[model samples]
Target chain A: MSPFVLDDRLERDSEFVTALGLCQLRLLKDSRWPWLMLVPQRAGKTEIFELTPLDQAMLTFEANLVAGALKQVTGAKKINVGALGNIVSQLHVHVVARHEGDPNWPGPIWGFGTAVPYDNDRKHAFLTALNEAIGS
Target chain B: MSPFVLDDRLERDSEFVTALGLCQLRLLKDSRWPWLMLVPQRAGKTEIFELTPLDQAMLTFEANLVAGALKQVTGAKKINVGALGNIVSQLHVHVVARHEGDPNWPGPIWGFGTAVPYDNDRKHAFLTALNEAIGS
Candidate 1:
C-alpha cells in the first residue's frame, strides 16, 4: 500500500487539529460555519466502503464524536454530515454546524458562497475551544 | 418512548422500499438521480449522534451497503452520502449516485431545482432493479 497523504485541496482549505483512531480531524477554514472534516488517513481510497470494516466503524465513531462536540461547542441548531467527493475526490467527511437563519439556511453549505477565512485570533480561539471540546 | 413515525416531508417525497437492521430504506421519488434514504426507526431523533452507539454502527454498515448497491445499479461515477436535516429534521441518511456532467455537477443535489418524479413504469422498473441489487 502507498503511504497516506492528505489531499492538496483539503490541506489548503482546512487546518489540521488532531488524529483520531482512523482519521485526521481537521477544521475547515471557512468562518461562515463551524465545519470540521474527518479524513481517514488511508491512501487512494475515495469512499467509505473502500475502507476495511474496522476502519469504517472507526470513521463513524469518530465522526459522531466530532459532530456531537461541534454541536455542543457551537450551539448549532443542526449538524450536517456529508461525504461528497464531487469536487475534491479525497474521501473526506464533512461535519458542519448549522444555525436556523444563517446565510444559507435550509440548504447544503457547499457552493453557497465564497468562504471567508477565520482571522488569526478567531482561528486560535475556535481551535482551542474545539480541541478542548473534543478532548484532543 | 414515542413510536417511530416517518416524517411527513420524507413520506411525501419518498417511497418505502424495505427495512434494514436499523433503518427503513426508502427510494426518493425523483427520477433525475438514483437516490436512496436510510431512516432509522427510532422516534424523535434528528441526528445520528442521538442514536445509541450500536445503531450508529448499524447505520454506517447499512449506508455502505446501500451506497455500493446504488453504484452498481446506476454505474455512477461517484456516490454521495449525507445526513443534513436542515429542512426535514429527520434522522435519515441520503445515499445518492452521481455522475459526471449531471445537472448539478460538482455541487450538491439539494434544492438545486424542482424534483422530477418518475413515471409509473419507470418507477416500477427502478424499484425492481434496486431491490434486486440490494437483495431485499
Candidate 2:
C-alpha cells in the first residue's frame, strides 16, 4: 500500500471526518451543504483514471457508499459528485449533499456563496450523525 | 455488447462526438465552456455505482481518455469531472475544461449564466477537432 499524504489545499479546506477503507472522508469546512470529500489514500495520484482497474472499482464503490450516507443524513434533494482539479490538483472526490433552496440551488456548489464554517455544536452533531450513517 | 439508448435530456443537451470501446463521447451543448459528457452504453443505468465492476473500470478509463482529449484540444487550464444525476436520472459523466477567465471563473458553472448554444460552424469545427484529438 502506498503511503498517502494529503495535499495542503485539502488540509486547509477541510476538517478531519474519519478514515474509510480506501479513502479519507473529510468534512468540508464550508458547511454550505453536507459535503464530504473522499480522497483515495494514494500518493501522487491526481486523477481517477490513474487508478488501476481494481482500484477504480474500489473508488467507485467507496464514493457511492459515502455519497449515499451523506444523502441519507442530509435528506439531500440531490448529490453532486465531482473531481475538479482546478484549484487543488489532488485526486479527491467531492460528495456533496444538495438540498433544495440552498444558497446556490440547482447549481454546482463550487466557489459559491461564502462558505460558513461549522459552529461547534452543529459540527459535532453533524459529524456524529455522519459517522453513524456511514457506519464508520 | 449492449446497444446504447441515449436519455432524452442527453440528446437534447449535447452533440455526439465519438465513442471509445466502453462509452460514447458527447460535447455538452452549453457553449459556456468546452465540456464533454461520457455515457456508458448500458441501458437503464442511473448511477456509477450501479455499473458492474468491469463496466466501472471501463467507464473510468474512457472518462480519462475523453478528458485528456478535451484538455489537449481546448488547452483548458483545468478539467472538471462529475456525475451528478440531479435533473436527469441517466448515468452521465461530465468532463468540463475550465479556462482561467471564464465567465464563472472560479465558481461552479451550473446555473451561473445562460448557456450559449453552439452555432453550426463552431460546433462542427469543435466536434471535428475533438474527434481527431481522441484519435477516433
Candidate 3:
C-alpha cells in the first residue's frame, strides 16, 4: 500500500499535534473553536467503511480518546465529531470543543466564517496542554 | 435504568425507520438530502464517549452499516457522518449521502437552509428502498 498523504487543504489549515493508534492528530488553526482532527494513516480512503474492520474499531477508540481529551482540556460544554469529505475527499474526522456561546453556538463549525489562525503563544500553550491531556 | 426517549426535536424532524443493534435508525424529513440518523437507545447520553466501550464499538459498526446502505441506495458520491449534539443533545449520529453539485455543494447541510419535508409518495418510496438496502 502507498504511504498516506495528508490533504493539501488540511495540511495548510492545521498543525500536527501527535499521532494516535490509527490516526494522525492535528489541531486546527482556527482560534475561534478548540478543534482537533484525526486523519487515519490510510492512503486513498475517503470514508470510514473504506477502512478494514480492525482499523475502523481503532478509529472509533482513537476518536473517543481524543474527544474526551479535548473536552477535558478545553472544558467544553459539548464536543462535535464529524467526518465530512465533500471538499477534501480525504477521510478526516473533526473533533470540535463547543461551548454554549461560542462563535457558532448550536451549529456545526465547518463553514461558519473566516478562520482566525491561532497566535504563536496561544497555539504553543494549547498544543502543550493537549499533548499532556492526551499523553502524547 | 430508564427507557430511552427520543428527543422531541429529533422526533419532530425524523421518522422511525428501524432499530439497529445499538441505535434507533431514523430517516430525516428533509427531501433535499438523503439523510439518516442513528440515535443510540441510551437515554440522557449526549456524547459518544459517554457510552460504554461496547456501545461505542457497536455505534461504529451500525454507523458504517447505515452509511454503506445509504450510499448503495442513493448512489451518493460521498457520505458525511456526524454526531453534533449542539442543539439537541440526544447523541444521534447523522449519515448523509451527498452528491457533487448538490444544493449545498462542498458545504455542510446542517443549519444551511430550511428543510423541505418529504412528500408522502416520495417519502414512502424512499423508506421502502432504504429498508430494502439496509435489509431491515
Candidate 4:
C-alpha cells in the first residue's frame, strides 16, 4: 500500500469534517449516539505506530481537541475515546460522546443496535459545527 | 508540573515491571481479578497524540502484547483497554482483564466495589508470570 493514498470512499464521505491539521474527522456511520472518528492524513496506516513521532503527537492532540469540540457541540455526559483495531484496520480513533440514557446505557457501544445513518441536513450541520469548533 | 511527574497515588505507588515493551504492567493494589495497567512511557503526554509517532506505534504494540499476556494470565472473558484521563491526567492506557460473572459483570467497572488489595503470594505469582511472558 502506498504511504499517502486516501481511500476515495473515505474522502467523499460527508459525515467527516476535514480539520485544519489535515486529518479527516468523521462522525461514525452510526447514529445510535454522538460518535466521531479522527483519521490522520497518512495512508496505508493500519496502526498508530505507522506514523512518525511528531505525527503521533498530532493524532493525540487532535483526539483531545476533537473530543472537547464534540462535548461542546453535543453536550454529552461522558466521552469515550478508543482505537479498537478489530474491524476497520485504518488508524482511526473513535471519540464517542455518550449521553445519559443513551441506547445500551452503561454497556459497550458495539453490538447494541444497527447504526442509524444521519439525515442530510443533520449530517451537514454536525460537520459544520465540528469544523467551526476545530477552527478548521 | 514536570513532564514526568505523576501525582495520583496509584501512579506514585505503581511497581515498574521488566515488561517495558509489554506496556506499563502494574498489579492493581486492590487485586480484584488480576488487574494490570499498561501505561506507555512518553514525556509531555496528555493524550494519545502527545506521543511521538514512533511512541504511538510502540504503545499499540505494547498494548497488544499486554493484552495477550493478561488473557493467558487471568483467563478473562473481556479485556478492557482504555485511556480515560478523567482521574489521572496522563497518557497511560489501561488493559484490564474482566470475567462475565465478575462483580461488575455487563456493566462499567468504575465504582463497582471496594478495592481488594492483592495478597502476597498472588501478587508475586502474577508479576513473575507477566515478567516471564514479557522476557524483560
Q: CA lDDT of each candidate?
A: 0.92, 0.82, 0.92, 0.66
Each candidate's clash count: 0, 0, 0, 10
TM per candidate comes to: 0.98, 0.84, 0.97, 0.60
Q: Second chain of candidate 4: TM-score? A: 0.85
Expressed as tens digits, the lDDT of each residue in A1-136 for candidate 4 is 5576555544443265575474777766777787877788787765554566677667766777787788788876666776544444556677877766788755557446677887878878877887788787
Task: Order the numbered candidates by TM-score, best leading.
Answer: 1, 3, 2, 4
Q: Which number leads on TM-score?
A: 1
DockQ of 1: 0.92
Give all candidate RMSDs, comma-separated.
Answer: 0.9, 3.2, 1.0, 6.8
Report the C-alpha lDDT of model 2 over A1-136, residue by residue, as the tens digit: 6678899989999978898878888988887788889998888776676777667778887888887787778877677899987778778999988777887677678877688888889989988998998898
Error of 1 at B105 (Å): 0.9
Error of 1 at B83 (Å): 0.4
- Cα lDDT tens digits, model 3, B2-76, are 999989999999989998999999989899999999999998899999999999999999999889889988899
* Candidate 1 wrongly placed segments (more than 4 Å): none
Cα miss at A118, model 2 (Å)?
Answer: 2.5
Instruction: Please say which candidate is ahead in lDDT: 1 or 2.
Output: 1
By descending lDDT, how would the candidates be arranged? 3, 1, 2, 4
Clashing pairs in 3: none
Residue-wise C-alpha lDDT for candidate 1, range B7-33, written one tens digit per residue: 999999999999898999999989888
Model 3 lDDT per residue over A15-122, tens place: 899888899999888999999999999999999998999999999999999999899999999999999989898899999999998987887898889999888998
**What DockQ does each prediction reach against the true complex?**
0.92, 0.56, 0.92, 0.16
Per-residue alpha-carbon lDDT of model 2 for B16-129, expressed as tens digits?
Answer: 778788788888878889888888888878767668877877887788778778878898877889987777877899898898988777666666767788888988898888
Model 3 residue A87 CA deviation in Å: 0.5
Q: Which candidate is the best by lDDT?
A: 3
Q: Give the range of the ten consecutive residues with the poorest summed lDDT in model 4 chain B.
A: B1-10
Give stretches of model 3 more than 4 Å off.
Answer: none
